[model samples]
Target: MQCSQDIAAPSEVGAYLLEHLPQATLITLDTTGHCPHLSAPLETLAAMETFLAKE
Candidate 1:
């Protein structure tokens, strides 16, 4: 998962991973910072739950 406004890693990194890694999932939280789990816990957890449910 990645934050939309994350500068440390950036959304492009997630995009690249998603493109290169098989079955990879990219969740972009609509917030700032690099740590989505800390900066946007609920959204992060929700995204994780949703993804895990699919798996």
Candidate 2:
């Protein structure tokens, strides 16, 4: 799942998933809104590309 910046808000447990799921890559996109897919599609795509390229 693509986690946007809002997930970084205080008390957001979803952000902790990255630490919990070390096996799965956690792609955190710095976005201004709640939906990265909508607010920053190009940036989000670039971030996804970078994430996918990681081992």
Candidate 3:
């Protein structure tokens, strides 16, 4: 899974990255940059635990 937080999406660099990817799992945190777990540690951990458990 790929996670991103408050990052620019319209840049050519961003578009280029998207072009090379296949099916993706995106976890977009409500909080901005500078560590999403810091803002929502338990929520992030729970999501991660659930995802990991499935694997």
Candidate 4:
């Protein structure tokens, strides 16, 4: 979910998350909003699959 986009400058939100939530693995998708699976299904699925495959 793109729940965090509500914060200022959604495009740069990843930076904030990375700095504050250091343990979290944040991935930013361009031109997407809350419920990216619906807004950007292909990109979202690809990113999820790639993350899952990582060792």
User: Which candidate achieves the best lDDT against the true structure?
Assistant: 1
Candidate 3 residue-wise lDDT, 1-55, digit = tens:
2235535442344345666767434555455544557767876787788877877
Model 1 Cα lDDT, one tens digit per residue, 1-55: 8899999997779999999999888888899998888899999999999999997
In model 2, pairs of residues that clash are: none
State the weakest 10-residue window (summed lDDT) of model 4: 1-10
Q: Report lDDT per candidate.
A: 0.90, 0.66, 0.55, 0.66
TM-scores of all models?
Answer: 0.91, 0.60, 0.49, 0.61
Compute the lDDT for candidate 1.
0.90
Q: For model 3, which pairs clash?
A: none
- Best TM-score goes to which candidate? 1
Q: Cα lDDT for residue 31, model 4? A: 44
Off by over 4 Å in 4: 1-9
lDDT of each residue in 1-55, candidate 2, tens digit only: 4545474453245557656877866565666666777888898889878878884
- The candidate with the higher TM-score, 1 or 2, is 1
Candidate ranking (TM-score, best to worst): 1, 4, 2, 3
Provide backbone clash counts, one per model: 0, 0, 0, 0
Residue 21's C-alpha lDDT in candidate 1? Answer: 98
- Give candidate 4's TM-score: 0.61
